[model samples]
Target chain A: MLDFSILINNLDTYLEGFKNTVLASIIALIGSFIIGVIVAVMRIAPIKPLNWIGSAYVEFIRNIPLLIIAFFFYIGLPSIGVTLSGFVAGTIALAIYTASFIAEAIRAGIQAVPKGQMEAARSSGLTYLQAMRIIILPQAIKIVIPPIGNQFINLVKNSAILGMIAGLDLMYFGDLVSSHTFVTFPVYIFVAMFYLVLTIPLSLGVGYLEKRLARSH
Target chain B: MFKSKTSKIAGVLLLSASMLLSACGKGDKETSGTAAKNALEQIKSKDKIVIGVKYDTRLFGLKNPSTGDVEGFDIDISKELAKDLLGDAKKVEFKEVTSKTRIPMLNNGDIDAIVATMTISEERKKEVDFSDVYFDAGQSLLVKKGSAIKGLEDLKKGTKVLAVKGSTSAINIRQKAPDTTVLEFENYTEAFTALKAGQGDALTTDDSILYGMADQDSNYELVGGTFTDEPYGIAVKKGNKELVDAINSALKKMKENGKYDEIHKKWIKSH
Candidate 1:
């Protein structure tokens, strides 16, 4: 039988872990979104070095495994006199790692927009930046919503990496509970439920946003 | 219409979640039957016993990357048990288990016994049966040789102590040094690596394990001797009395034949 007793006894531990996980996911989501947008613009901009830097950041980050990035922040940075707490390190790693994919999605969406939209705006006396912001971005965003939603959902789930570095997230407490009680299956199922509590709502919210945006257009 | 569709999707998710739970409940029943049988008979029937050993603890069952084999005190003892039972030292199959995984893995029938650097405790006794203490170990601290911190006493507020997850050292330190922050890693290697990377002020674990780490690197040394007695034992599934008795007898024979001392000197004293 699944041990409900382990769950009841360690509710505080689970809740603490749940709190940290939610905090890490939220911070990473916002951080990655900002970085992703900036890099997306830089990659598509008419500048040369900016395109190289943008391409380099995306290619370098998306290629490496997430654990290595998290480890770099957690265990690597201290040698250079940059010491970050586990939560800070893990969240920052999640942001930097996920931003690469988000930037890719945004860039693809921007490209999918007809070139005439940008050309037409620039011909009508709008600057390139203004055309992008006014005419191009709004349309690109609608096209990007589905893929961006996918990345955000992935971002939430990948926040579990925080647990590996003892960021005290839900997965970390799940490991603690399983080790403490020697009950592995039930503990992880409950941890999954906690993650679902965060992710399911997020997924549904994205679906709803996609639908609403489509209707408004 | 959209509201109805959204509700339907939510309904499907809820139904699937319940299905997963019930499926797991069914799995629990299938495994219980095998657990009721005596493990000793099962080992004899199989002709070889699978024992879980740590693949990370340096001198106690660490996997040598070059050789592709795990070697240590715990591994040697496991082989001796296999030889005593199955009449050949090679009759043992090794599985890697960490401090967090060893107990569940044993209970789940993944291994016949756990020969990892496991500390016997009353709480764990409720989950699994332990043979007599094979090795007497104690909890201690490892820090840089010139560290200002000396021992458990010096671990004050804001001190970050690194320990392996699910280990007694992690639990013990929380109780002993209530004010200090205990950061746990997945295994000893990560904890020790974190210590060297300055992630924590000290690393805490069994002195035997700390000795292995200290031996591997000259910069770190054990401090404050031992704070808590951690008697290592070979754990089997709970209620496996026959297997427990056989292990105890096998251990006694090893002690009497001077085989235990020989193995200890090779792994422990040589370091």
Candidate 2:
């Protein structure tokens, strides 16, 4: 049976989980975007060492599972005396892991801009940095919007990993409710609905922004 | 391209919607089917009993890495039950179950009975049937040696106690020590690992399980001798009265014959 009673009974628990999930996702989204941009720029920058570091970071993080990264922060870090709560560790791991993929998306976006645009900007008395700041990045942002939006959506769903580490996110509370009630199916169905509540708007916002960018161009 | 992307999104939406509707439909059919044949007859017809047990808890049913076998007091009891039912000790299959998954697995008929180190509580009795207590464990704390926390009274505000999610210990600690923060993990291994890594001040669970952890690593020892009694029982699906009765009789016979004491001595007393 489609049970609404489980959801109604555990409304406060679900809401607490919802709030933590939202907080974790927002913090991670902003953190990953900023880190992603910096790493993307470093990969494309003129300096050789910076490019190596950027590639190393992206390749290392992207290759390993996000769960291991989260575990490292949760269980591995405390051995050397750096202890972080589950929420803090899970959020940091989310940001760190997602940044690699976001970096790749941005790098591809930056490269998609025609080489002639950069040359033209530089030839017109704009410095390389100025040409990049004004012409290259703006165009790259437009190109990267869809992929970055995709990453953001993935990040929101992936925040469920926090639950495994006792981060008190939506999926964690979902487990709690299901375990307490032994009503497995409905609890997760409701949890999925909560995630959709965050992601559908994100998907629509991306579509809207894509359209607006196309119009401006 | 945009049109294709929109269509893909629409396809995903449709797929998820259908999945949600079909899941409920399937669940209804499964529950209805459970009414026809009880689990005892089904197990007898199959000739092999499937048991759910923990592959992580050391003194209970831990999977030995070198031997590639689950060896513990619980596994021995399950084997004896298999022998009693099908005339062969090996006529049983073990499916690993955690604190979170055992009840669901039992109710889903994935396993006929759960012999995991599961505590019997009134809340759980509504969903499943429990046999007489096979092991009398009590909730206790595991702290690193030489720590200031020696007992439950020492767990003041700002103290963090780690427990497995979906466990009675988690609920009990939250009630008994309301001021201390409780951190729950997916399983005992992770909780113990977290404690070793200094993530929590102490880890709380059944004293039997804590004994397993301490036996594994001498650095950690049991503190706070038993705050609550955790009577572990083999769980079967609710309404499976025949299966419950069969298990209860089997346990009674084991106790009468001293097989139960032998198992306890082998796994518990030695440690």
Candidate 3:
């Protein structure tokens, strides 16, 4: 029922797409995590303006569609003389969009930490920044591991949108192969399998990490 | 708890797999049932024909956003065919189709025909029968007016060529200029937008589509005379000789009666 020759002949194309997807997802993962951390810190900081900016950023980004943000970078940025390749534009958009949700998750984790913990750190002569870095964040991250993992998984799936702007990701190449071969169902099935190959391992790793983190606590 | 979670995940995976298998079975069943009567005869008895047309292509078959009506060269051609076949121009239903979905939709009997500025190609001919060329187009380049690239020859190594995904233009560009990097977007609009944004050096597609883009924005112009001949045709299901003959006759009538020229003037003249 399924033809394997198309898959066999076009292995390189599929691999190129898979490589782009992995590269984009990894970059966006690291980029969004960093942004999420910073935004989460700002949201919890004592400075009012910083807190407002953080809150506004989260609200604005989380509320709008990721595609719009991607289009803004892909189509809107070039008008201002800031042109980026599809991969870069899509990664940046994915990072920015995902950061908002990550910020909320991190913030929730931070808030879940006992107030006494912060007071205890300050009483021990640790600066607020030091307390956040050396004390609170590590524990907050540990507590929020599952949610963050879920976000990471979502980030991988959302990366499919990169196909829209011609990022050369898996879905994009899958579309190309399917259209060229006119074997839509099987081509997509293979594409889905490739995605599962990326995501299932990540999902399992997250579950393992969650279990380990829970045991440590 | 870990065991339970693993089992749950496995259960969900199993369920989805079964669902997909069932869907494939259904698709096979649907595609197997060919109507014994010719499509033209069926359409005549039904008194309505379904045409799959592009809702995104601008001059060819774009849907008017404000009016919620599809209008363009392809739509006009479909209407004219309807008039010739059924004696009523309005006796046709329009279904939106993209390049990717048009063939599958036609094969599945979801649409009686495809009049979506589809290029007649040997590869596509194996899947569906096509009417005689209703519109003559060719592959061309759209670039910023002052760009260094003059034509297809300038599309050398490292030259970024943007084309729509699943389009023959992308394949043709690669064959014509193998060294040029081809980026395929979901549609011409996205590809054109990316060209304006400096995403690629040139946008390659049918000259008719490039004309539409050039018409929309004066800054971009068709850089090359058509590099590849792309004759557009109305497609029907493969082996539907009766339907193919009916469409070919209708097209011949349209040309003889000057209706074809009227449509060409309406959509292609300004471009």
For each candidate, what is the lDDT?
Answer: 0.91, 0.91, 0.91
Worst 10 residues of 2 chain B by lDDT: B29-38
Better of 1 and 2 by TM-score: 2
Clashes of 3: 0
What is the full ranking by DockQ, best candidate first?
Answer: 3, 2, 1
- Residue B144 CA displacement from its true place in model 3, Å: 1.4
lDDT of 3 at B123: 91
RMSD, one per candidate, in order: 6.6, 5.1, 5.5
Q: Please, what are the lDDT tens digits per residue for candidate 3 over residues B87-126?
A: 9999999999877678889988889999987999999998
Q: Sort by lDDT, best first: what order? A: 2, 1, 3
Predicted model 1 interface RMSD? 1.3
- For model 2, residues B243-265, the per-residue Cα lDDT tens digits are 88899999999999999999999
* Range of the 10 consecutive residues with the lowest summed lDDT in candidate 1 chain B: B29-38
- Chain A only: TM-score of every candidate? 0.95, 0.95, 0.96
* lDDT string, candidate 3, A69-160, tens digits: 99999899989989988888999999999999999999999999998999999999999989988889788988898899989999999999
Clashing pairs in 2: none
- In candidate 1, which residue ranges exceed 4 Å CA deviation? A1-11, A79-81, A181-190, B1-37
Against the true structure, whose DockQ is highest? 3
